[model samples]
Target chain A: MHLTSVLVIGATVIALLVLAVYVIAVRTPEGKLDHVGGMRLVLWLGAIFPTVVLTALLLWALPAMRPLPHQSGDLRIQVQGEQFWWRLRYEDGNGPGVISANEVRVPVGRTVVFDVTATDVVHSFWIPGLGGKMDMIPGRINRLVVKADKPGIFRGVCAEFCGLSHALMAFDVIAMEPSAFDAWLASARGVPARADGRGAELFSANGCGACHTVKGTPHTAMIGPDLTRLGERRSLAAGTLPPTLESTAAFIRNASRFKPGARMPAYSAMPIEDATEIARWLRSADGEAGR
Target chain B: MNRDPLKWHERLRVSLWTLIVPPAVWAGHFLFSYLWASISCAKVGSFARFPTLFVAGTVVALAIILVSGWIAWKQQRMTGDPPPHESGTQIDRLRFIAKSTLLLAGLSFVAVLFSALPVAFLSDCR
Candidate 1:
């Protein structure tokens, strides 16, 4: 049976149960409402029967949901959900794995544990193809286990109704070959030069430091995405925008333009030359890590 | 219409829609978001919202509403009828059905449905 069909059938069963209670209610005697007998029967069936059934279902589901008792040696990824974007820090500790936004790539046929949390309002972490959904709440860490039976892209969204643009806040999961993943991670961590250019100058001149942070640089802001390796990420704007250079430039210049009510202010009204220069500087500064 | 015993469908309709729609919508929205996140991040986890409590509350409340409305509806239907209105025997029979059916079995089922819905749906038991 199709999965969705099961959901519908379950819902139908609930409806049927409710209907049964209503029918029983009409059978009660007039004026003298018995708090004990007639009501007790309906309440018991309505309440108790479902309790047992649901408890059984939950017991059945826990093992599949939790990590298997002997399961070990899996990969861990720290996934942080900010106001309107997703921040990823791989647990490798060797160096930063691809610091991309909205795009998650993992090796196929391995259990990946996602340590997820929200920096702002409650955001739910969900992936339909892999398993269920976990909430990313401030001050609370939720763990999600995902195993891609094969190499494919899975779609995910913020299950909680966050503030504005919540509908637009989405992401993707890419499961690929182990070698391909390692190669991508290597390229992602590669350092670029801190050459004297338009991007570097704007990095200091613009008020970008108030929200974003860059390691070993003057941009110490932690209110937004970490830019220590911004250029290395697959997607930009917390997965709201694609990872293309043009999209990154547009987001830097005017994030609200892409996602309305975005927290980031737009630099579109700034001098066109300045915007272009900043874009160019950031574009070149992509791989300047460890330089 | 058999005039021997009362019917409960009308009262149950109110319980079904009023108690069911709002929370069901909430669950639906949550489910949609989880599906989106899973696809985007390649991570699957249990949905963390307390939708079960909300749904259970709705069902329980609906049960209350159904009982109350059923009494009113039964009174209206049986008015001016031939049955003895003031006798305790009739009361006992009514109590038996409510105790046996609505309260015990019916309420229990609603609670069960509430908790089961999320997990069932989470597993794509849609």
Candidate 2:
């Protein structure tokens, strides 16, 4: 069983014991004890008994509170919380930092240190199943070191209230095997092969390059999230919708409809075909596409 | 009126100030623990591995509370009229205050120990 389950069960038993003691004390015969006798009873049961029990409990819980040990060679991932998205940068002692958005991937059974911070307002990075929440304050970096023992996809969200779309801000945490994760990270470092096509033309025509970045292309602006591996991301619009072709097109045309206060302006004037092409181009740059 | 069992100097020595000593030590320990943790995290990026200073502070607080409790225990055990202390004699009042201070000391001893528990467990700011 989980440590939390054991703690809850223990607490329930203690509470029930206390309740039983209270009931017994209240139901005891009145006038049976003198004032001195009553004072002795209170001193023993009320003061000494509780102090002893609490000290034992404190000792039992102290070991669990110890922080997990980490080393300098651990994989460091810097996660910067924006208004309604997560900007992720992976640094595995590799050449350059690999930037992604709205999704976090880690190697199972390995220490992953998240250097969490914020760009605008304060946010909190919380992956409830993995570790405790860490506040992401502007100009201050807070480190949240975690290790995923099992390989699976978990959902993480912004635990702190930041803006109108705070509830909509979420991310996917994918824990992969060490080999697969290493391969993915290595491939992510290389440029996508399919940066030119009809969809690419449409994406450039719409001036998306001025804000967003696509690796290996001249659109290297950092105003928005890097779409280098958007196609492989599990979710779109920060876990608001599935990363389907239609949803991507819809979001591209009218992002504000799904997430209020999003910085991406709605391209309501753009034709459906043009929006679809842009979305397609964005999704085609996965590492697999290059291979 | 019953003869004042406690002289004026003795009464002054066991004033309300004595009653508050235990809890005041507990409060000081609590504040000092948190401040120590905050400063350690800010300067060292984590709590010190040894934390000798924090341990010393806690030992001093616990020692003060223990001493206070011992004094109160001695005063409570002094010969006085038993049971219903309704006579409000000087001895009765002194014993009552002593008993109250003893209980407070017991409570504060545990409080200080509990406040220091976190230091023993958590080694980092997290």
What C-alpha lDDT values do all the predictions have? 0.62, 0.87
lDDT by residue (B29-121, candidate 2, tens digit) is 999988888888877776764489989998999999998888888887767777665566887877788878888998898898888887767
How does the DockQ of candidate 1 come out? 0.04
- lDDT tens digits, residues A1-291, model 2? 576897799789879988997898799898877787888887887878778877887888788657688888899999999989999999988789899899999999999999999999999999987888999999999988899999999999999999999999999999999999999999988986775688888888889999899988889888888987888998899999988888999999999899999999989999988888888778877633321
Interface RMSD, candidates in the order listed: 9.6, 1.7
Q: Which candidate achieves the best TM-score against the true structure?
A: 2
Q: Which stretches of candidate 2 lie over 4 Å from their true place?
A: A22-28, A32-45, A193-197, A286-291, B1-15, B40-46, B76-97, B124-126
Can you give the lDDT of residue B96 in candidate 1? 37
Question: Where is the poorest 10-residue window by lDDT in model 1 chain A?
Answer: A63-72
